[model samples]
Target: MRLFILGLGYSAGHFVRKFGGAFSHVAGTVRDPAKRNDLAGIEVHAFSGSRPGDATLERISEADVLLVSIPPGNGGDPAIAAFADVLAERRRKIIYLSTIGVYGDHGGAWVDESTPPQAAFERTRLRLAAEQAWTNNGSGHVAILRLAGIYGPGRNALVTLRAGTARRIVKPGQVFNRIHADDIASAIMAAILHGRGGTWNVCDDEPAPPQDVIAYAAQLMGVAPPPEEAFETAEMSAMARSFYASSARVSNAKLKCEFGVTLAYPTYREALDALWRAGEGR
Candidate 1:
């Protein structure tokens, strides 16, 4: 099997590390030609332009599986906008990495794949629109994984705590779901192997408060938890504060039942503990 990735960012990179061995050929696009060295064996193509060049399209056409992890810009999905026609004709299995934010402020209510999107922000609206575009333009089976806040290795709360940027901002009754990077890769691999088509929520078993996660990370690191600041009085950027607006407990029932996935890090505590032991925060 040949696998091609549109954006080899963090999550997609993890996917490659976990599953690239299964494919006979692997290639991906990166915005910077200078970072080609970082991609190791995979063929790296320049994708910094408005549309993929002829060489990139040739790579896209040669793949048996494709994963898109790029966010939509104002002009919309770069891949879909550029090669929707070509993609519609390919027999490739496609997966689009999307966010759980599309479900919008559920008032801490539980949500699943069946719930209709009620996007609360322009970013999420764009994601929803991009998802629809892929669904409409593509003849191949597309599995959309609506992921939660992703954390692993250098990107978790332990790193934030060590950096002295960990903040315990208390928002009463507000909770958010999260998934470890390895789990995200695992879920994607499951989707690829099963050839499932449709939307699925990819997250851990627990939905927790932001403050609680930070506190737990602190405990694991043997450090004092950051001082609490009520959300109303906290000094934060608009983007950071906007995350609190969508308080939903995302369910992973579909991921487990439909895809038969067993998450490597089923909860934030498990992931944080493992990262801490591995000295990821240090």
Candidate 2:
């Protein structure tokens, strides 16, 4: 199998790391020249502009699977648009990494694949549109992975806690869902190996209040937990505040039932605890 990834962000990085040599050929794109050397052994190409390089195009055409991790933005994805014609012709399987934010504020309700996306935020609305663009381009081989807030290793919110920057903002009964990077990678692998297409949520089974998570991380670090702030009065940037606006208990039942996969870290406590121990070199 051949795999070509259009984006090299954190999720894509984990995907390639977990499935690099499984394919006969694996090629990826990065925006930075300095980072081009980061994807050693695997073919890496620069893609700052809309145009796809010759090597990148060839890799896409020959790829059995094309994974796109570029998040939705104002201008949308030019690389995907640039290769839409060839992609339509190749009939290659495509996986687009999306976010559960597309579901909008569900009032902490559990949502599954059957639920229609009612994106209430601009970013998620853009994502919904991007999802449509890909589906409208061609066949049904495209699979969309709607991931939860991804945390693992150095990227965990625990780092923010340890830095004494963690905030405990209680928004009544607001809840959040998160998934580990390893679990996200495993879900992608399951989707690929099983050849399943359609939307699937890749999240952990646990959903907890934001304050509880902050307190838990602080407790594990043996530090006094930060005091709570009024959710409405909490001082946060527009983007950060926007993120806290939505609350939902994202379901992973579809992932387990359909993909026959179980999370490596089923709960935030387990995941954060593991990361804490690992950081302490225990």
Candidate 3:
């Protein structure tokens, strides 16, 4: 199979790293090709949501599978807008990475694929529109994978605590769903194999308080946990604070049942344990 990725981001890049050998050809787009030398052995092209290079266009034309990891902007999906002709002319398996934030402020309740998207933020509203656009007009089967907070390898709480940047923000009754990058790759593979367009939640089994995660990492490192700051008075960026606006335990039962896959890290504890063993912080 030939694979082409719209945004070779952290999770999508991890997918390629894990499964590139399965494909005969692998190519992807980054905003800047010059800085992506680390993506050796895979064709890297430049595409900042407009005016894709000829090489990128050629790869898209040749791809048998397409993974879109880029979020929609104010103007909507760049891939759909830029490559309408190329995509519409051919059939390819498409995997779109969406976020569980579309469920919007579920008040710490559990949300599943069947729940209607609330989309309290404009960005998530744009995501919802982009998802519909792909399903409505995509040339072939489109798998919409709604993901949770992602962490893995060098990007986990362990590394943050070691770097002295970990924060323990306390919010009453606030819980968040998270997924390891490895499991995200698994979900991508499953979506490719399933081949029947559908939406599924991609997350671990836990819906945990944010502070507990930092404290656990500190414990693993034999260091004191960062002091906790109440959400109401915590100093955080707008985007960071915005995340606390919604709390939902997203269910991935559909992913497990339909894809017939087992998560390597089923919860944050298992994931942290595995990361610690892998020397992520030490």
Root-mean-square deviation of every model: 1.1, 1.8, 0.9
TM-score of 3: 0.98
User: lDDT tens string, model 2, 60-164?
Assistant: 878898888876668876655677777876676788888888887888888888888886777777899888888777454778889998888777758987666
Local distance difference test values of all predictions, in order: 0.89, 0.82, 0.92
Question: What lDDT score goes with residue 232 in model 3?
Answer: 100
Report the Cα lDDT for candidate 1.
Answer: 0.89
lDDT of 3 at 264: 99
Q: Candidate 1: give the clashing pairs.
A: none
Q: Name the lDDT value of residue 166 in candidate 1.
A: 87
Ranking by lDDT: 3, 1, 2
Worst 10 residues of 2 by lDDT: 33-42
Q: Over the stretch 103-200, how does candidate 3's per-residue lDDT look in tens digits?
A: 99888988899999997889989999999988977799999999999999999999999888999999999999999999999999999989599899
Which is the leading candidate under lDDT?
3
What does the lDDT read for residue 279 in candidate 2? 87
**Which candidate achieves the best TM-score against the true structure?**
3
lDDT of 1 at 117: 96
